[model samples]
Target: MPNWVDGHPAESLSIKDRGLAYGDGLFETIAVRAGRPPLLEYHMARLAEGCQRLGIPLDLQLMRTELLAFSAGLGEGVAKLMITRGEGLRGYAPPPVALPRRILQSSPFPVYPQVNGVEGVQLFPCVTRLAEQPLLAGLKHLNRLEQVLARNEWQGSEFAEGLMRDQSGRVIEGVFSNLFIVHEGALITADLSRCGVAGVMRAALLDSARAQGLKVEVRDIPFEDFLQADEVFLCNSLFGVWPVRSVTGHHWPVGPLTRKLQAIARDLLDI
Candidate 1:
């Protein structure tokens, strides 16, 4: 698969790009199926919000066109779209007139153990806590060192994901995915107004749960409260859903609600 920079095939980026210097940009990891992104609108919506918040002038229509063409050519794979605030001088202040650079890259779909999606998996407890940044809370920005550190907390196949919390110790999400819990028949997830990435699959599942008449709540979850959940699950765009069977010393069975939502996610990803 060829990499595209500003809509042309390229393998290199400018040395002074703001995205490399100050992480001044946003990105989207999309799952392409049969020449198209299944959740493109969701990804674009997030990108638009990120661009607006960061004051990056993005050509959404042109990006949509390029993404469609690139994904069509690749046929099947993960499409990574990165928009950076173009090259800058030796300072923190952004350019008075910004010219955003669009980079599109493709990689083969990831392969995970089949048991992970079926029998469920364990979650590693990460000591790395997410800082509360309301301004950049839900945006999939370029700064991801926190997640990098948290992901390295555990090694080996024993743990499929790591559970992350906010600085205040509120259960936030997974290292690379969103966290959801079923409690007393209510489907609850963390309030991303303070931190954590609002994953595309998480959004879709929330809507699906509501449509299926399940009670939904989006609020800050205490660590103790999260541990008492009837069932827990994690989700991301690349890998639909994985039922979290255990984290730390607590354990949860793959309940009916989790299985139902997992099926919904599988259908959404067409896996």
Candidate 2:
């Protein structure tokens, strides 16, 4: 992977950096294909919103210029941008003047099996539940210890992804992807007003699906109701889409809606 710090080639960050000290940062994982980031706007918009909400100063125009330059020679891969609150003293008090640190990284696209999207994949129900934190909900902040713990609950190919639930026992999302269930001819996804990362792919799909006259509901989906869905799928900026064949004991065949949405995602990603 290639990395850059503050728009320059660098490999290390200070130990006093708030990102390392207190996980005080936000990051975006962008998919780059054919030397372009198709959904750059969505990623940038989300990042900007997080910055504003957290009182972090970010130069979006400069970040955009840097992103384009970084991805220019890269054909197909992933680009990660992390903005931290910068170095600070040994206490929790914020510095009077903040100088945010920008770290950009480029890596080769992850190799996933073709069948993961075509034939679907199995999901493991994680025991670790997401804590309700409305303040931090929907933002891709640096605190991902919950996801890391959930992911560690499983190993190997038996389960392609791990499903996480909120403290209320409502299905929230996958460890590394957003969850969507199709039921009664409508698309249903979890409400991220309380928890979960509002993935860029999920946002794009919501718009596209509604534009096509598809019924889409963004609300709390209980575990029981989720199991009764007609079809299920997971999505992220990198993987595109993966139909959920089964979660725990419940099984769902890849339905037409999943395929339809997958096609839309492919077009949006220009794949």
Q: What local lDDT does model 1 show for residue 8? A: 95
Give lDDT per model, in order. 0.93, 0.92
What residue pairs are clashing in model 2? none
Per-prediction tally of clashes? 0, 0
Tell me each candidate's TM-score.
0.98, 0.98
Top model by lDDT, which number?
1
Candidate 2: where are CA atoms >4 Å away? none
Q: What TM-score does structure 2 among the candidates reach? A: 0.98
Q: Write model 2 residue lDDT over 41-98, tens digit each, in one string.
A: 9998999999998888888899899888777766679989899999888898878888
